[model samples]
Target: MSDAPREIEALIEMMAKLPGLGPRSARRAVLHLIKKRGLLMNPLAEAMQAVAQTARECLNCGNISTGDVCPICTSEKRANGELCVVEDVADLWAMERSNVFKGRYHVLGGTLSALDAVGPDELRIPKLIDRVTSEGITEVILALNATIDGQTTAHYIADQLDGRVNVTSLAQGVPIGGELDYLDDGTITAALRARKSL
Candidate 1:
Protein backbone atom coordinates (compact mmCIF):
# COMPACT_ATOMS: atom_id res chain seq x y z
CA MET A 1 0.00 0.00 0.00
CA SER A 2 2.88 2.35 0.67
CA ASP A 3 4.18 2.14 -2.92
CA ALA A 4 1.12 0.95 -4.90
CA PRO A 5 -1.26 3.31 -6.69
CA ARG A 6 -4.39 4.36 -4.78
CA GLU A 7 -6.75 2.33 -7.03
CA ILE A 8 -4.69 -0.85 -6.66
CA GLU A 9 -4.37 -0.38 -2.92
CA ALA A 10 -8.12 0.15 -2.67
CA LEU A 11 -8.74 -3.02 -4.64
CA ILE A 12 -6.49 -4.93 -2.28
CA GLU A 13 -8.35 -3.54 0.70
CA MET A 14 -11.72 -4.54 -0.75
CA MET A 15 -10.49 -8.03 -1.66
CA ALA A 16 -9.15 -8.50 1.83
CA LYS A 17 -12.70 -8.12 3.15
CA LEU A 18 -13.86 -11.21 1.28
CA PRO A 19 -14.37 -14.29 3.48
CA GLY A 20 -11.18 -16.41 3.04
CA LEU A 21 -8.93 -13.57 1.86
CA GLY A 22 -6.40 -11.61 3.91
CA PRO A 23 -4.16 -8.65 3.26
CA ARG A 24 -1.26 -10.79 1.99
CA SER A 25 -3.37 -12.82 -0.48
CA ALA A 26 -5.37 -9.79 -1.55
CA ARG A 27 -2.20 -7.96 -2.60
CA ARG A 28 -0.97 -10.96 -4.58
CA ALA A 29 -4.37 -11.45 -6.21
CA VAL A 30 -4.68 -7.80 -7.16
CA LEU A 31 -1.25 -7.95 -8.74
CA HIS A 32 -2.22 -11.09 -10.67
CA LEU A 33 -5.49 -9.60 -11.84
CA ILE A 34 -3.79 -6.39 -12.89
CA LYS A 35 -1.09 -8.23 -14.82
CA LYS A 36 -3.73 -10.24 -16.70
CA ARG A 37 -6.30 -7.47 -17.06
CA GLY A 38 -6.81 -8.09 -20.77
CA LEU A 39 -7.37 -11.85 -20.50
CA LEU A 40 -8.49 -12.44 -16.89
CA MET A 41 -9.37 -9.20 -15.17
CA ASN A 42 -11.55 -7.80 -17.95
CA PRO A 43 -13.47 -11.02 -18.46
CA LEU A 44 -13.73 -11.56 -14.73
CA ALA A 45 -15.13 -8.11 -14.24
CA GLU A 46 -17.65 -8.66 -17.01
CA ALA A 47 -18.70 -11.97 -15.53
CA MET A 48 -19.11 -10.40 -12.11
CA GLN A 49 -21.24 -7.68 -13.61
CA ALA A 50 -23.36 -10.24 -15.42
CA VAL A 51 -23.93 -12.29 -12.31
CA ALA A 52 -24.71 -9.24 -10.26
CA GLN A 53 -27.36 -8.32 -12.78
CA THR A 54 -28.86 -11.78 -13.11
CA ALA A 55 -28.41 -13.39 -9.73
CA ARG A 56 -31.51 -13.35 -7.54
CA GLU A 57 -33.01 -15.26 -4.66
CA CYS A 58 -35.49 -17.91 -5.76
CA LEU A 59 -38.92 -16.93 -4.50
CA ASN A 60 -40.06 -20.45 -3.73
CA CYS A 61 -37.01 -22.08 -2.13
CA GLY A 62 -34.72 -19.19 -1.21
CA ASN A 63 -31.86 -20.46 -3.39
CA ILE A 64 -30.03 -17.95 -5.53
CA SER A 65 -31.22 -18.10 -9.11
CA THR A 66 -31.41 -16.07 -12.27
CA GLY A 67 -35.18 -16.38 -12.33
CA ASP A 68 -38.04 -16.13 -9.86
CA VAL A 69 -37.68 -19.77 -8.96
CA CYS A 70 -34.43 -21.69 -8.88
CA PRO A 71 -33.92 -24.54 -11.32
CA ILE A 72 -34.25 -27.11 -8.57
CA CYS A 73 -37.49 -25.67 -7.21
CA THR A 74 -39.00 -25.39 -10.68
CA SER A 75 -37.89 -28.79 -11.91
CA GLU A 76 -40.63 -31.39 -11.78
CA LYS A 77 -38.06 -34.09 -11.20
CA ARG A 78 -37.04 -32.44 -7.96
CA ALA A 79 -40.57 -32.47 -6.48
CA ASN A 80 -40.11 -35.88 -4.94
CA GLY A 81 -42.07 -35.24 -1.74
CA GLU A 82 -38.80 -34.38 0.00
CA LEU A 83 -37.35 -31.06 1.11
CA CYS A 84 -33.93 -30.40 2.61
CA VAL A 85 -33.91 -27.51 5.06
CA VAL A 86 -30.58 -25.74 5.35
CA GLU A 87 -29.43 -22.95 7.61
CA ASP A 88 -27.84 -20.90 4.87
CA VAL A 89 -27.56 -20.72 1.09
CA ALA A 90 -23.96 -21.85 1.44
CA ASP A 91 -25.16 -24.98 3.23
CA LEU A 92 -27.58 -25.63 0.39
CA TRP A 93 -24.74 -25.23 -2.10
CA ALA A 94 -22.59 -27.67 -0.18
CA MET A 95 -25.41 -30.23 -0.24
CA GLU A 96 -25.75 -29.79 -3.98
CA ARG A 97 -22.03 -30.34 -4.39
CA SER A 98 -22.51 -33.72 -2.72
CA ASN A 99 -24.65 -34.73 -5.74
CA VAL A 100 -26.55 -37.19 -3.63
CA PHE A 101 -29.71 -35.38 -2.59
CA LYS A 102 -32.26 -35.22 -5.40
CA GLY A 103 -34.86 -33.18 -3.59
CA ARG A 104 -35.26 -29.41 -3.42
CA TYR A 105 -34.19 -27.09 -0.57
CA HIS A 106 -35.52 -24.44 1.79
CA VAL A 107 -32.88 -21.94 2.86
CA LEU A 108 -33.73 -20.49 6.27
CA GLY A 109 -31.20 -17.72 5.62
CA GLY A 110 -29.72 -18.31 9.06
CA THR A 111 -30.19 -20.16 12.31
CA LEU A 112 -32.37 -19.10 15.21
CA SER A 113 -30.42 -16.87 17.55
CA ALA A 114 -31.81 -15.53 20.78
CA LEU A 115 -28.67 -13.55 21.56
CA ASP A 116 -28.93 -11.71 18.28
CA ALA A 117 -32.74 -11.59 18.53
CA VAL A 118 -33.20 -13.65 15.36
CA GLY A 119 -36.44 -15.60 15.17
CA PRO A 120 -38.59 -17.49 12.66
CA ASP A 121 -39.97 -14.28 11.17
CA GLU A 122 -36.49 -12.93 10.65
CA LEU A 123 -35.58 -15.84 8.40
CA ARG A 124 -37.62 -17.75 5.75
CA ILE A 125 -39.20 -20.10 8.29
CA PRO A 126 -42.75 -19.06 7.50
CA LYS A 127 -42.12 -19.45 3.80
CA LEU A 128 -40.77 -22.91 4.45
CA ILE A 129 -43.95 -23.89 6.26
CA ASP A 130 -46.06 -22.69 3.37
CA ARG A 131 -43.94 -24.59 0.87
CA VAL A 132 -44.27 -27.86 2.74
CA THR A 133 -48.03 -27.80 2.57
CA SER A 134 -48.45 -26.24 -0.85
CA GLU A 135 -45.78 -28.38 -2.49
CA GLY A 136 -46.95 -31.60 -0.87
CA ILE A 137 -43.68 -32.07 0.91
CA THR A 138 -43.82 -35.32 2.89
CA GLU A 139 -40.36 -35.51 4.40
CA VAL A 140 -38.19 -32.63 5.57
CA ILE A 141 -34.51 -33.39 6.08
CA LEU A 142 -32.68 -30.91 8.30
CA ALA A 143 -29.18 -30.27 7.00
CA LEU A 144 -28.38 -27.53 9.45
CA ASN A 145 -24.97 -27.35 11.12
CA ALA A 146 -24.26 -28.97 14.46
CA THR A 147 -23.85 -25.68 16.26
CA ILE A 148 -26.04 -24.77 19.22
CA ASP A 149 -27.96 -22.21 17.26
CA GLY A 150 -28.31 -24.61 14.35
CA GLN A 151 -29.78 -27.31 16.57
CA THR A 152 -32.10 -24.81 18.16
CA THR A 153 -33.33 -23.71 14.77
CA ALA A 154 -33.80 -27.33 13.72
CA HIS A 155 -35.85 -28.13 16.79
CA TYR A 156 -37.92 -25.02 16.29
CA ILE A 157 -38.75 -25.97 12.73
CA ALA A 158 -39.44 -29.56 13.69
CA ASP A 159 -41.94 -28.43 16.27
CA GLN A 160 -43.57 -26.13 13.77
CA LEU A 161 -44.19 -29.02 11.39
CA ASP A 162 -44.83 -31.66 13.99
CA GLY A 163 -47.04 -34.56 12.88
CA ARG A 164 -47.89 -32.72 9.70
CA VAL A 165 -44.86 -34.22 7.91
CA ASN A 166 -41.98 -36.48 8.69
CA VAL A 167 -39.12 -34.42 10.07
CA THR A 168 -35.57 -35.71 10.20
CA SER A 169 -32.10 -34.32 10.75
CA LEU A 170 -28.63 -35.07 9.50
CA ALA A 171 -26.96 -37.75 11.62
CA GLN A 172 -24.55 -36.85 14.41
CA GLY A 173 -21.46 -37.03 12.27
CA VAL A 174 -21.22 -33.31 11.56
CA PRO A 175 -18.42 -31.77 13.61
CA ILE A 176 -19.48 -29.87 16.70
CA GLY A 177 -19.76 -26.14 16.06
CA GLY A 178 -18.86 -26.72 12.40
CA GLU A 179 -20.57 -25.06 9.49
CA LEU A 180 -21.79 -27.10 6.53
CA ASP A 181 -19.94 -24.86 4.11
CA TYR A 182 -16.67 -25.98 5.72
CA LEU A 183 -17.32 -29.70 5.26
CA ASP A 184 -16.23 -31.93 2.37
CA ASP A 185 -18.71 -33.40 -0.07
CA GLY A 186 -18.30 -36.97 1.18
CA THR A 187 -19.10 -36.02 4.75
CA ILE A 188 -22.20 -34.22 3.59
CA THR A 189 -23.34 -37.22 1.56
CA ALA A 190 -22.73 -39.55 4.46
CA ALA A 191 -24.67 -37.29 6.77
CA LEU A 192 -27.57 -37.16 4.37
CA ARG A 193 -27.60 -40.93 4.03
CA ALA A 194 -27.56 -41.43 7.79
CA ARG A 195 -30.17 -38.83 8.65
CA LYS A 196 -32.43 -39.78 11.55
CA SER A 197 -35.89 -38.72 12.62
CA LEU A 198 -36.05 -35.61 14.75
Candidate 2:
Protein backbone atom coordinates (compact mmCIF):
# COMPACT_ATOMS: atom_id res chain seq x y z
CA MET A 1 0.00 0.00 0.00
CA SER A 2 2.98 2.34 0.41
CA ASP A 3 3.63 4.59 -2.61
CA ALA A 4 7.38 4.67 -1.79
CA PRO A 5 9.90 2.50 -3.64
CA ARG A 6 10.29 -1.08 -2.43
CA GLU A 7 13.79 -0.52 -1.07
CA ILE A 8 12.78 2.66 0.78
CA GLU A 9 9.71 0.93 2.15
CA ALA A 10 11.87 -1.92 3.37
CA LEU A 11 14.21 0.52 5.11
CA ILE A 12 11.28 2.28 6.74
CA GLU A 13 9.88 -1.07 7.91
CA MET A 14 13.20 -1.95 9.48
CA MET A 15 13.41 1.40 11.24
CA ALA A 16 9.88 1.03 12.52
CA LYS A 17 10.93 -2.03 14.49
CA LEU A 18 13.22 0.05 16.71
CA PRO A 19 11.95 0.90 20.15
CA GLY A 20 9.89 4.15 20.44
CA LEU A 21 9.61 4.36 16.66
CA GLY A 22 6.34 3.77 14.82
CA PRO A 23 5.65 3.48 11.14
CA ARG A 24 5.10 7.22 10.68
CA SER A 25 8.25 8.08 12.65
CA ALA A 26 10.20 5.49 10.70
CA ARG A 27 8.99 7.04 7.43
CA ARG A 28 10.09 10.49 8.58
CA ALA A 29 13.46 9.14 9.77
CA VAL A 30 14.01 7.23 6.55
CA LEU A 31 13.25 10.34 4.55
CA HIS A 32 15.61 12.38 6.71
CA LEU A 33 18.33 9.77 6.28
CA ILE A 34 17.80 9.80 2.53
CA LYS A 35 18.00 13.59 2.41
CA LYS A 36 21.17 13.59 4.56
CA ARG A 37 22.68 10.45 3.10
CA GLY A 38 26.00 12.05 2.29
CA LEU A 39 26.38 13.82 5.62
CA LEU A 40 24.82 11.35 8.06
CA MET A 41 23.56 8.07 6.60
CA ASN A 42 26.86 6.87 5.18
CA PRO A 43 28.75 7.52 8.42
CA LEU A 44 25.97 6.01 10.49
CA ALA A 45 25.84 2.87 8.38
CA GLU A 46 29.59 2.43 8.58
CA ALA A 47 29.67 2.98 12.33
CA MET A 48 26.81 0.58 12.92
CA GLN A 49 28.42 -2.04 10.72
CA ALA A 50 31.74 -1.68 12.54
CA VAL A 51 30.06 -1.93 15.93
CA ALA A 52 28.02 -4.92 14.85
CA GLN A 53 31.22 -6.73 13.95
CA THR A 54 33.15 -5.79 17.11
CA ALA A 55 30.47 -5.71 19.80
CA ARG A 56 30.55 -8.65 22.16
CA GLU A 57 29.54 -9.36 25.75
CA CYS A 58 32.28 -9.15 28.33
CA LEU A 59 33.00 -12.59 29.75
CA ASN A 60 33.55 -11.29 33.28
CA CYS A 61 30.59 -8.91 33.82
CA GLY A 62 28.20 -9.38 30.89
CA ASN A 63 28.75 -5.81 29.67
CA ILE A 64 28.80 -5.06 25.96
CA SER A 65 32.40 -4.65 24.94
CA THR A 66 34.65 -4.76 21.91
CA GLY A 67 36.96 -7.25 23.61
CA ASP A 68 36.86 -10.27 25.88
CA VAL A 69 36.75 -8.07 28.99
CA CYS A 70 35.45 -4.56 29.30
CA PRO A 71 37.83 -1.77 30.43
CA ILE A 72 35.97 -1.41 33.74
CA CYS A 73 36.39 -5.06 34.62
CA THR A 74 40.05 -5.02 33.62
CA SER A 75 40.83 -1.79 35.51
CA GLU A 76 42.60 -2.33 38.84
CA LYS A 77 40.96 0.76 40.27
CA ARG A 78 37.53 -0.74 39.68
CA ALA A 79 38.36 -3.68 41.96
CA ASN A 80 37.35 -1.83 45.12
CA GLY A 81 35.76 -4.81 46.99
CA GLU A 82 32.29 -3.48 46.14
CA LEU A 83 30.25 -5.05 43.32
CA CYS A 84 27.25 -3.20 41.91
CA VAL A 85 24.50 -5.51 40.62
CA VAL A 86 22.36 -4.31 37.74
CA GLU A 87 19.66 -5.96 35.63
CA ASP A 88 21.04 -5.10 32.22
CA VAL A 89 23.88 -3.49 30.27
CA ALA A 90 21.95 -0.23 30.00
CA ASP A 91 21.87 0.06 33.81
CA LEU A 92 25.60 -0.50 33.93
CA TRP A 93 26.11 2.21 31.30
CA ALA A 94 23.91 4.61 33.26
CA MET A 95 25.94 4.04 36.44
CA GLU A 96 29.15 4.57 34.48
CA ARG A 97 27.76 7.88 33.18
CA SER A 98 27.24 9.09 36.76
CA ASN A 99 30.89 8.26 37.63
CA VAL A 100 29.92 7.72 41.26
CA PHE A 101 30.39 3.99 41.78
CA LYS A 102 34.07 3.13 41.94
CA GLY A 103 33.71 -0.63 41.91
CA ARG A 104 33.05 -3.21 39.20
CA TYR A 105 29.58 -4.34 38.16
CA HIS A 106 27.66 -7.61 37.62
CA VAL A 107 24.91 -7.44 35.02
CA LEU A 108 22.16 -9.99 35.76
CA GLY A 109 20.78 -9.59 32.21
CA GLY A 110 17.25 -9.70 33.60
CA THR A 111 15.24 -10.10 36.81
CA LEU A 112 13.31 -13.17 37.90
CA SER A 113 10.01 -13.18 36.07
CA ALA A 114 7.69 -16.11 36.59
CA LEU A 115 5.51 -15.07 33.69
CA ASP A 116 8.52 -14.95 31.39
CA ALA A 117 10.14 -18.07 32.91
CA VAL A 118 13.25 -16.11 33.88
CA GLY A 119 15.28 -17.53 36.77
CA PRO A 120 18.74 -17.46 38.31
CA ASP A 121 20.06 -19.86 35.72
CA GLU A 122 18.67 -17.69 32.96
CA LEU A 123 20.57 -14.66 34.27
CA ARG A 124 24.25 -14.21 35.12
CA ILE A 125 23.57 -14.95 38.81
CA PRO A 126 25.89 -17.95 39.01
CA LYS A 127 28.68 -15.86 37.54
CA LEU A 128 27.94 -13.18 40.13
CA ILE A 129 28.35 -15.65 42.98
CA ASP A 130 31.54 -16.95 41.47
CA ARG A 131 32.94 -13.41 41.20
CA VAL A 132 31.95 -12.59 44.75
CA THR A 133 34.21 -15.35 46.02
CA SER A 134 36.93 -15.18 43.40
CA GLU A 135 37.24 -11.38 43.46
CA GLY A 136 36.89 -11.06 47.27
CA ILE A 137 33.92 -8.76 47.04
CA THR A 138 33.07 -7.24 50.44
CA GLU A 139 29.75 -5.66 49.58
CA VAL A 140 27.17 -6.23 46.84
CA ILE A 141 25.08 -3.18 45.96
CA LEU A 142 21.75 -4.02 44.34
CA ALA A 143 20.83 -1.22 41.91
CA LEU A 144 17.78 -2.88 40.44
CA ASN A 145 14.79 -0.82 39.34
CA ALA A 146 11.92 -0.33 41.80
CA THR A 147 9.50 -2.83 40.38
CA ILE A 148 7.82 -5.97 41.66
CA ASP A 149 10.07 -8.28 39.65
CA GLY A 150 13.16 -6.22 40.44
CA GLN A 151 12.43 -6.39 44.19
CA THR A 152 11.82 -10.10 43.96
CA THR A 153 15.12 -10.58 42.15
CA ALA A 154 16.95 -8.43 44.73
CA HIS A 155 15.52 -10.45 47.62
CA TYR A 156 16.51 -13.68 45.95
CA ILE A 157 20.06 -12.46 45.41
CA ALA A 158 20.27 -11.23 49.01
CA ASP A 159 19.11 -14.59 50.30
CA GLN A 160 21.61 -16.37 48.12
CA LEU A 161 24.44 -14.16 49.42
CA ASP A 162 23.23 -13.91 53.00
CA GLY A 163 26.22 -15.08 55.07
CA ARG A 164 28.97 -14.86 52.47
CA VAL A 165 28.88 -11.08 51.77
CA ASN A 166 27.16 -7.91 52.89
CA VAL A 167 24.18 -6.99 50.70
CA THR A 168 22.54 -3.58 50.26
CA SER A 169 19.98 -1.95 47.97
CA LEU A 170 19.76 1.47 46.39
CA ALA A 171 17.55 3.81 48.43
CA GLN A 172 14.10 4.07 46.91
CA GLY A 173 12.32 7.35 47.60
CA VAL A 174 11.64 10.77 46.14
CA PRO A 175 14.01 11.65 43.31
CA ILE A 176 16.23 14.71 43.38
CA GLY A 177 14.42 17.93 42.41
CA GLY A 178 11.09 16.05 42.51
CA GLU A 179 8.13 17.76 44.24
CA LEU A 180 6.55 15.79 47.08
CA ASP A 181 3.04 16.63 45.86
CA TYR A 182 3.75 15.06 42.47
CA LEU A 183 5.05 11.82 43.96
CA ASP A 184 2.93 8.74 44.43
CA ASP A 185 1.90 7.34 47.84
CA GLY A 186 4.58 4.66 47.63
CA THR A 187 7.29 7.25 47.01
CA ILE A 188 6.01 9.45 49.84
CA THR A 189 5.92 6.49 52.19
CA ALA A 190 9.41 5.37 51.23
CA ALA A 191 10.78 8.91 51.57
CA LEU A 192 9.24 9.20 55.03
CA ARG A 193 10.59 5.84 56.09
CA ALA A 194 14.06 6.60 54.72
CA ARG A 195 14.06 10.10 56.21
CA LYS A 196 17.48 11.43 57.15
CA SER A 197 18.71 14.24 59.40
CA LEU A 198 18.32 17.54 57.53
Candidate 3:
Protein backbone atom coordinates (compact mmCIF):
# COMPACT_ATOMS: atom_id res chain seq x y z
CA MET A 1 0.00 0.00 0.00
CA SER A 2 1.16 3.55 -0.74
CA ASP A 3 1.99 5.85 2.19
CA ALA A 4 0.35 8.83 0.47
CA PRO A 5 -3.41 9.23 0.63
CA ARG A 6 -5.53 8.06 -2.31
CA GLU A 7 -6.29 11.65 -3.49
CA ILE A 8 -2.66 12.71 -3.35
CA GLU A 9 -1.51 9.55 -5.11
CA ALA A 10 -4.07 10.13 -7.84
CA LEU A 11 -2.94 13.72 -8.29
CA ILE A 12 0.67 12.59 -8.54
CA GLU A 13 -0.21 9.99 -11.16
CA MET A 14 -2.02 12.60 -13.29
CA MET A 15 0.84 15.06 -12.98
CA ALA A 16 3.28 12.36 -14.07
CA LYS A 17 1.38 12.08 -17.32
CA LEU A 18 2.33 15.66 -18.23
CA PRO A 19 5.03 16.15 -20.91
CA GLY A 20 8.22 16.38 -18.83
CA LEU A 21 7.12 15.21 -15.38
CA GLY A 22 7.80 11.66 -14.24
CA PRO A 23 6.72 9.82 -11.08
CA ARG A 24 9.46 11.23 -8.85
CA SER A 25 9.02 14.77 -10.13
CA ALA A 26 5.26 14.51 -9.81
CA ARG A 27 5.56 13.36 -6.21
CA ARG A 28 7.84 16.32 -5.40
CA ALA A 29 5.47 18.66 -7.20
CA VAL A 30 2.46 17.31 -5.33
CA LEU A 31 4.27 17.69 -2.00
CA HIS A 32 5.23 21.25 -2.90
CA LEU A 33 1.69 22.07 -3.95
CA ILE A 34 0.35 20.69 -0.69
CA LYS A 35 2.80 22.84 1.28
CA LYS A 36 1.89 25.92 -0.74
CA ARG A 37 -1.82 25.17 -0.93
CA GLY A 38 -2.94 28.66 0.06
CA LEU A 39 -0.54 30.62 -2.09
CA LEU A 40 0.10 28.55 -5.24
CA MET A 41 -2.16 25.49 -5.36
CA ASN A 42 -5.46 27.34 -5.11
CA PRO A 43 -4.53 29.94 -7.69
CA LEU A 44 -3.14 27.33 -10.08
CA ALA A 45 -6.26 25.20 -9.74
CA GLU A 46 -8.53 28.19 -10.36
CA ALA A 47 -6.50 29.24 -13.39
CA MET A 48 -6.58 25.74 -14.86
CA GLN A 49 -10.33 25.45 -14.27
CA ALA A 50 -10.99 28.82 -15.88
CA VAL A 51 -8.89 28.01 -18.93
CA ALA A 52 -10.44 24.57 -19.30
CA GLN A 53 -13.87 26.14 -19.31
CA THR A 54 -13.12 29.01 -21.68
CA ALA A 55 -10.23 27.88 -23.91
CA ARG A 56 -11.11 26.80 -27.45
CA GLU A 57 -9.52 26.40 -30.88
CA CYS A 58 -9.82 29.28 -33.31
CA LEU A 59 -12.20 28.20 -36.09
CA ASN A 60 -10.36 30.02 -38.87
CA CYS A 61 -6.66 29.36 -38.12
CA GLY A 62 -6.76 26.43 -35.67
CA ASN A 63 -4.95 28.56 -33.05
CA ILE A 64 -6.02 28.28 -29.43
CA SER A 65 -8.32 31.11 -28.36
CA THR A 66 -11.22 31.90 -26.06
CA GLY A 67 -13.30 33.07 -29.01
CA ASP A 68 -14.27 31.56 -32.36
CA VAL A 69 -11.48 33.41 -34.15
CA CYS A 70 -8.06 34.06 -32.62
CA PRO A 71 -6.86 37.61 -31.89
CA ILE A 72 -4.33 37.42 -34.76
CA CYS A 73 -7.02 36.35 -37.20
CA THR A 74 -9.29 39.25 -36.24
CA SER A 75 -6.60 41.92 -35.92
CA GLU A 76 -6.54 44.35 -38.87
CA LYS A 77 -2.80 44.92 -38.46
CA ARG A 78 -2.04 41.24 -39.05
CA ALA A 79 -3.80 41.09 -42.43
CA ASN A 80 -0.58 41.70 -44.35
CA GLY A 81 -1.32 39.27 -47.22
CA GLU A 82 1.31 36.91 -45.81
CA LEU A 83 0.52 33.61 -44.08
CA CYS A 84 3.00 31.61 -42.02
CA VAL A 85 2.01 27.94 -41.76
CA VAL A 86 3.21 25.87 -38.81
CA GLU A 87 2.60 22.24 -37.84
CA ASP A 88 1.53 23.04 -34.28
CA VAL A 89 0.44 25.88 -31.99
CA ALA A 90 3.76 25.71 -30.11
CA ASP A 91 5.49 26.77 -33.32
CA LEU A 92 3.07 29.65 -33.69
CA TRP A 93 3.79 30.73 -30.12
CA ALA A 94 7.53 30.48 -30.80
CA MET A 95 7.19 32.72 -33.86
CA GLU A 96 5.19 35.20 -31.83
CA ARG A 97 7.90 35.24 -29.19
CA SER A 98 10.50 36.04 -31.86
CA ASN A 99 8.41 39.04 -32.97
CA VAL A 100 9.75 38.55 -36.50
CA PHE A 101 6.72 37.66 -38.53
CA LYS A 102 3.97 40.29 -38.47
CA GLY A 103 1.65 38.32 -40.73
CA ARG A 104 -1.10 35.96 -39.58
CA TYR A 105 -0.55 32.25 -38.91
CA HIS A 106 -2.22 28.97 -39.85
CA VAL A 107 -1.71 26.14 -37.37
CA LEU A 108 -1.94 22.74 -39.08
CA GLY A 109 -2.47 21.00 -35.68
CA GLY A 110 -0.13 18.23 -36.96
CA THR A 111 1.86 17.24 -40.00
CA LEU A 112 0.77 14.71 -42.62
CA SER A 113 2.11 11.23 -41.83
CA ALA A 114 1.66 8.10 -43.90
CA LEU A 115 2.97 5.82 -41.17
CA ASP A 116 0.53 7.31 -38.68
CA ALA A 117 -2.28 7.29 -41.26
CA VAL A 118 -2.60 11.09 -41.01
CA GLY A 119 -3.65 12.63 -44.33
CA PRO A 120 -4.31 16.13 -45.62
CA ASP A 121 -7.95 15.83 -44.53
CA GLU A 122 -6.79 14.95 -41.03
CA LEU A 123 -4.79 18.22 -40.99
CA ARG A 124 -5.98 21.73 -41.96
CA ILE A 125 -4.66 21.59 -45.56
CA PRO A 126 -8.02 22.15 -47.22
CA LYS A 127 -8.81 25.02 -44.93
CA LEU A 128 -5.39 26.53 -45.72
CA ILE A 129 -6.18 26.44 -49.44
CA ASP A 130 -9.47 28.17 -48.80
CA ARG A 131 -7.76 30.85 -46.69
CA VAL A 132 -5.15 31.66 -49.35
CA THR A 133 -7.80 32.70 -51.84
CA SER A 134 -10.35 34.10 -49.44
CA GLU A 135 -7.85 36.23 -47.51
CA GLY A 136 -5.99 37.46 -50.60
CA ILE A 137 -2.76 35.95 -49.30
CA THR A 138 0.17 36.87 -51.55
CA GLU A 139 2.77 34.69 -49.82
CA VAL A 140 2.71 31.54 -47.70
CA ILE A 141 5.75 30.93 -45.48
CA LEU A 142 6.08 27.30 -44.39
CA ALA A 143 7.78 27.20 -40.99
CA LEU A 144 7.33 23.47 -40.60
CA ASN A 145 9.89 21.28 -38.82
CA ALA A 146 12.75 19.62 -40.68
CA THR A 147 11.51 16.11 -39.99
CA ILE A 148 10.56 13.86 -42.89
CA ASP A 149 6.89 14.25 -42.18
CA GLY A 150 7.22 18.02 -41.86
CA GLN A 151 9.06 18.30 -45.20
CA THR A 152 6.47 16.06 -46.82
CA THR A 153 3.64 18.23 -45.52
CA ALA A 154 5.37 21.39 -46.73
CA HIS A 155 5.83 19.96 -50.22
CA TYR A 156 2.19 18.88 -50.34
CA ILE A 157 1.00 22.33 -49.33
CA ALA A 158 3.30 23.92 -51.87
CA ASP A 159 1.78 21.79 -54.62
CA GLN A 160 -1.71 22.63 -53.47
CA LEU A 161 -1.05 26.37 -53.59
CA ASP A 162 1.08 26.30 -56.77
CA GLY A 163 0.45 29.11 -59.25
CA ARG A 164 -1.90 30.74 -56.74
CA VAL A 165 0.54 32.36 -54.31
CA ASN A 166 4.28 32.67 -53.73
CA VAL A 167 5.13 29.72 -51.49
CA THR A 168 8.34 29.77 -49.40
CA SER A 169 9.99 27.77 -46.64
CA LEU A 170 12.13 28.91 -43.73
CA ALA A 171 15.85 29.22 -44.51
CA GLN A 172 18.62 26.71 -43.67
CA GLY A 173 19.23 27.77 -40.08
CA VAL A 174 16.69 25.29 -38.71
CA PRO A 175 18.57 22.08 -37.80
CA ILE A 176 17.55 18.80 -39.33
CA GLY A 177 14.91 17.01 -37.23
CA GLY A 178 14.69 20.07 -34.92
CA GLU A 179 11.34 21.62 -34.07
CA LEU A 180 10.60 25.33 -34.21
CA ASP A 181 9.43 25.38 -30.59
CA TYR A 182 12.95 24.42 -29.49
CA LEU A 183 14.69 27.13 -31.50
CA ASP A 184 15.89 30.40 -29.97
CA ASP A 185 14.36 33.75 -30.93
CA GLY A 186 17.43 34.92 -32.88
CA THR A 187 17.54 31.78 -35.02
CA ILE A 188 13.87 32.11 -35.83
CA THR A 189 14.36 35.78 -36.79
CA ALA A 190 17.32 34.96 -38.98
CA ALA A 191 15.47 32.09 -40.66
CA LEU A 192 12.43 34.22 -41.41
CA ARG A 193 14.56 37.01 -42.80
CA ALA A 194 16.45 34.60 -45.07
CA ARG A 195 13.48 32.49 -46.20
CA LYS A 196 13.52 31.38 -49.84
CA SER A 197 11.00 30.19 -52.39
CA LEU A 198 10.03 26.54 -52.18
Which structure among the candidates has the greatest TM-score? 2
Per-residue lDDT, model 3, residue 77, is 100
Q: Which whole-number lDDT from 0 to 100 does residue 62 have in model 3? A: 93
- Angstrom error of the Cα, residue 166, model 3: value is 0.4
Tens-place lDDT digits, model 1, residues 1-198: 378988889999999999999999999999999999999999999999999999999998889999998999889999999999998889998999989999999999998898999988999999999999999999999999977899899999999999999999977657778799999887788778878899
Steric clash pairs (candidate 1) = none
Q: Is candidate 1 or candidate 3 better by lDDT?
A: 3
Error of 2 at 82 (Å): 0.6
Q: Residue-wise lDDT of candidate 2 within 31-95, one digit each (tens)?
A: 99999999999999999999999999999999999999999999999999999999999999999
| Model 2 misplaced regions, further than 4 Å | none
Tell me the tens digit of each residue's lDDT in model 3 across 78-102: 9999999999999999999999999
TM-score of each: 0.85, 0.98, 0.88
Q: Clash number for model 1?
A: 0
**lDDT scores for all predictions?**
0.92, 0.96, 0.95
What are the runs in model 1 whose C-alpha is more than 4 Å off? 174-198
